[model samples]
Target: MKTKESKKKRTEIQAVDLFCGVGGLTHGLILGGVKVVAGVDLDSICRFPYEANNAAAFIEQDVKTLSGKTVRKLFSERGLKLLAGCAPCQPFSTYSRGGRKSGINEDWELVASFGRLVREVQPDLVTMENVPQVEQHPVFQEFLSDLHGYHVSWSVVECSSIGVPQTRKRLVLFASKFGPEGLSISESNRRKVTVKDAIAHLRPVVAGQADKKDPLHIAPRLSDLNMKRIKASRPGGTWRDWHPSMRAACHRKVSGDTYPSVYGRMEWNQPGPTMTTQCFGYGNGRFGHPEQDRAITLREAAMLQTFPVGYRFLKKDEKAKFSLLGRLIGNAVPVRLGEVIAETLKSHVAFYASAEKRECA
Candidate 1:
């Protein structure tokens, strides 16, 4: 291992990523000069990509089982203890197929458990990301209440405003026990990056064809019927514009009126639809390319999440299928958004450390 001097030169601080899925947030923190000591997740499939892209160990264990001792050991050698987590947000996602109800959902319990870990380990700082609906959950409120002595701030943020290139919205929370009552982050006023800005430069390759230099830049294969459907789909157009024969059965039903975004094509100049776990499926959402004939690929989804073109998620020899990779990338917090979280925490850390110095003097 490198000496402390080299390690400190490499990163501003160390963090532990809880519920880390394929390391999107972890990678972002790493890029912002934070050393991620470990990434924890329940999904075994995340191991390959999480470890490959972020120089951190992957612990395929449920966060519910995380112990204070284990968490402290994760940082014992480095004297670093900054905790960051994006818990499983299915229960609070607006896209939840299951309607919202408090007592019935067990996922709410996990958030409290996450709080327990924080209260026990007592990290210098904490950061969390989740769907906007999470703020409405009582458990989330309770978690904030538990941090009574800590400074906490949370907001519903539009990822597109932060250059994510997708119209995803999320709730970001930052807490520091030693800083000001709350850290303020100004909303970005920069022009939104559209789907065209993200993927227009890639050479046009048919479905299943990899880019000459980047093997991971391959789109998924569509079925024969889907191929015919995509041919009829136009940028910013929906199946409503398609021939009658190409309409999905659900689209033909009365209830489908509420779900017109599916089987839809993206507009070139606008931000892409909020990427979901099944973004690889053209019929799942507005996943069809703005002009390309294929659905959005894993590489495109990662780029929309603000991952670099050279970021490696899977090894060359790995099967590295799109279905799983798509889930990892689509469900991830856009790394750019994570950078905003890092910046917020960095400011608070700096402020508190300065305050402590003045007190000692």
Candidate 2:
């Protein structure tokens, strides 16, 4: 089903990341040797970090309003053009089920729009990463059907299987105008990274306090009652482990018993829980520190997402607001997983280029 254009060999690869939140995918691709020409997103706040960290132009335009012609203009004429689109995954996330209503129709429409650009631009390669629930949506099926001229490969990727220190699972797709024989990312053989491996060396700060040295290491202030609860809480233990007087009124109700992952501390030797948008809040999921009487800091959350320790999420003189930085870190694709995808695409291109050379001889 690959197009005839796929048969040609390329000397390099160039890409543009769509819905690129904070440049996690762009950084990974750059580390894998791809020249990312531009990153497109609607959020203006992302401009500073995306442009500051990566050498690509940040196009602050909605993907729905973007045209294939506009995207093609950004590509270098000499390389294999690639498109990477990771539309907002809330529309199909497991957390969005049961009338949670985190997504809108526009979100679903973005996937179809991504497919439209692929058909119109006819890029040599494409990659998309989203929640696994997206696989069950009609938009996903429609997206797959649109790939008639491209070789496509997709699967649910376990983040821990690829050396990420979290248990996040995502649906990843890789497609090429070349044949589909070699598109899957192989599992990494490296030992699983643990929470201790990530944040153990940071200078310690207590609840309601920031490390004097690192601005991002500030923890949220806990209420007196909440502070007492955390004191009684053990790693991997929930509110159920607390003394009877410390139990919340909701926990006494039968319905609240099922939400045991809340108000729990992370285990040091194990990977941390999935970092969500409210990861900076102690009451959100199991976000409490294993030993400390506070939730992990913004910097700790970013590190758990596999960002480099010194990666700057804010500019000089900018204040580190918890909600702003938390959303940025939580919504980002883990940098390590992005690297895995980039490496897979690089190898796939190499295999086909070698095959084409043998045919020419």
The whole-model lDDT of each prediction reads 0.78, 0.85
The estimated TM-scores of all candidates read 0.88, 0.93
Expressed as tens digits, the lDDT of each residue in 1-361 for candidate 1 is: 4466743432356799998887889888877667789998878777887887778999987788889789988985543468898877574331232244534366767678778889888887788887788888898988897677878888888888878888888888888766565375567888889988988887787886777677778887888888999999888777887889888898889998888778778888999988877887789989898878898777887887788877787777555577667767777878887777777666666665556557766
Candidate 2 structure quality by residue, lDDT tens digits, 97-123: 324455566678778888988988899
Off by over 4 Å in 2: 1-9, 91-103
Off by over 4 Å in 1: 1-12, 76-80, 91-104, 355-361
- lDDT, candidate 2, equals 0.85
